[model samples]
Target: MKKVLVTGASGQLGKCFQKIASEYPEMELRNFNSSELDITDQNRLQQIFSEENPEYCINCAAYTNVEKAEDDEETAFKINAEAVKNLAEVCKNTGTVLIHISTDYVFDGKATNAYRETDVVNPINVYGASKLKGEEYIRQILDQHFIFRTSWLYSEFGHNFFNTILKKAEEGATLNITTSQTGTPTNANDLADFILQLIREENSEFGLYHYSNLGEATWYDFAKAILEFSGKIDQVTLNKSGYYKTRAERPTYSVLDKQKLQETFKKLVLHWRDSLEDLIINRFRKI
Candidate 1:
């Protein structure tokens, strides 16, 4: 049986991978979060990898606190950049395929069109720069790898936009969301499914790819949709806020062009609204 090891198994995307892994009976799955395996500790990683000898290493671990990354640049780089380099080098030596998760923040949000896989990156914040550096490290050290760049990720297992809006609605609070910023919100489950498909297909020609649900929306639009979907649209008042500037400069328009993925995989995810509804009805309501 082919063995697959997933890092950051406690995260939203990692949980999604765990759920999808159940379908593959012929594949052995090993999962690890920060507590289980600290990628920054080279010796620890070496020991774990030596014992596991995984055929594929899906690296879902990352420092994703966007605003906090500004103050914690050293920690962020350690996880997002340095740790990635370590994993890529180990994967290269062990002849293991590495799947690295990245973000849309890598783009500067200056483009009028959706960013393609080949688009030049110009990160505007520390978090984005660190993730972009991780991508570069993977490219430099590993020959067989898949770098998936996604945006606005949410899931039932982690803190994200959808859960935040839901919490605010529960508190009977009016939320102020930015309408100027636009991008696609990707469900971690959909991304997990895509990763599973890629492994099954075993496409050797590896490179960067973008994955998100079909369509795009502003933060305001997404919040409104979430409220309406959760049957709390009447209670939530939507207000618009300007960019106003902050420690971490966010992209105004980081919508990724997923046509390359659509073309390559021939798989399309549901619209953000539809997926949000499904998540609420199935997962949030149960919790």
Candidate 2:
């Protein structure tokens, strides 16, 4: 059986992988949360790599707090950039294929058409810049790596827009979300399944690839869908400013073009709404 080591086990994406791990019984997966293994600690990473010697290392760990990243650029870079560099370096030496999770924020969000994998990156905020730096490190230091740039990730097990919207609707609280900001809402399960596909095939098409649900929606549309899908209707208003203000400026458009991924993986990417419905009904409702 193939051995895979997953970092950031407690994260939404990592948990999603854990949820469906049983389906892939041919692989032995060792999932580790931050507590079990801090990516920032190079010595610990080296120790683990030396001990486990996994054939594949899926790095789901990253600093994802966009708003907080503005104030804590150092910590964000440490986890997002420096830690990723550490992992890439270790993976290079150990001959382990490194699959790193990145974000669409790496792009400036200025493109009218969907951003492609080859699009020039210009991160507008600290979070995006940091993630881009991590990507650079992986590309510069390692050849055996898969960097998946995803956006608007949500899952049942973690704190995400999906659960937040459902909770707000249940409480009958009026909510205001940004209408200008647009991106694809990725169900982590879809991404998890795709990741497993690459590993199962021992896919060595190593490079940066964009992966997200098909189609696009604004934040408001996302909220509306969440409410409707959960069978709840609350006053979910669109707010252009004020209450929705953050320290960093968000990209007006960040829908990724998944042509490269879809073609390479030989899979059809589902529409965002369709995937959202499936997740809410089959997974979220059960919980």
Candidate 3:
């Protein structure tokens, strides 16, 4: 049986991957959250890799606090950049295939069209810059690797836009979201499934690929959709407010062009609205 090591096992995407693993009986899955494995601790990570000798390493761990990253630049770089470099180096040495998650923040969001994998990266904030650096390190060190750059991720297991808005709506609090910024809202489960599919196929044609649920919307639109889906549309007051400001600069538009992924995989993710509805029915309805 092939063994797979999943880092950041407690995160939304990590948990989603864990659920996906149940369907594959031939694969042995070992999961590690930050408490179990700190990617920044080089010696510990080296020890684990030597003992476990995983055939594949899925790096889902990251410092993803976009606003906080401005103040915590060092920590952000440590996890998002340096730790990634460490993983890539170790994976390369051990001849292990690496699957690293990245973000759309790598792009400047100036382009009117969707961002392709080949597009020039000009990150406008610390978080984006750090993630981009991680991508560069992986590409340089690991010969067998896949860097999946996704955007606006949400899931049932962790802190995300959907749950946040739903909680606020339940509390009868009005929500003001930015309408200017636009991007595709990706479900973590979909991405996890895609990763497993890639692994099942053992795709050696490794490179950067963009994966996100189909369709695009602004934060304001996303909020409204969530409220409506949660049956809290009446309790929620949707307002377009530029009043909220953060230390980190965000992209006005960061939707990715997934043509390459479609061409390669011969399939595309489900429409965002369809997936959103399914998630609400599956997750929120049970609550």
Using TM-score as the measure, which candidate wins? 3
lDDT per residue (tens digit) for residues 1-287 in model 2: 98999999999889988989999998989999999999999999999989999999999998989999999999999999999999999999999999999999988888999999999999999999999999999999999999999999998877899899887876778787778788999999999999998899988888989999999998888888888887776445434332366899788899999999988889878999999999878855654
Q: What TM-score, computed on C-alpha atoms, does each candidate reach?
A: 0.95, 0.96, 0.97
Off-target runs (Cα >4 Å) in candidate 3 are: 285-287
Better of 1 and 2 by TM-score: 2
Model 3: per-residue Cα lDDT over 23-115, one tens digit each: 877788899999999999999899999999999999999999999999999999999999999999999888899999999999998999999
lDDT (0 to 1) per candidate: 0.89, 0.90, 0.91
On a 0 to 1 TM-score scale, where does candidate 1 land against the true structure? 0.95
lDDT accuracy of residue 250 in candidate 1: 93
Worst 10 residues of 2 by lDDT: 234-243
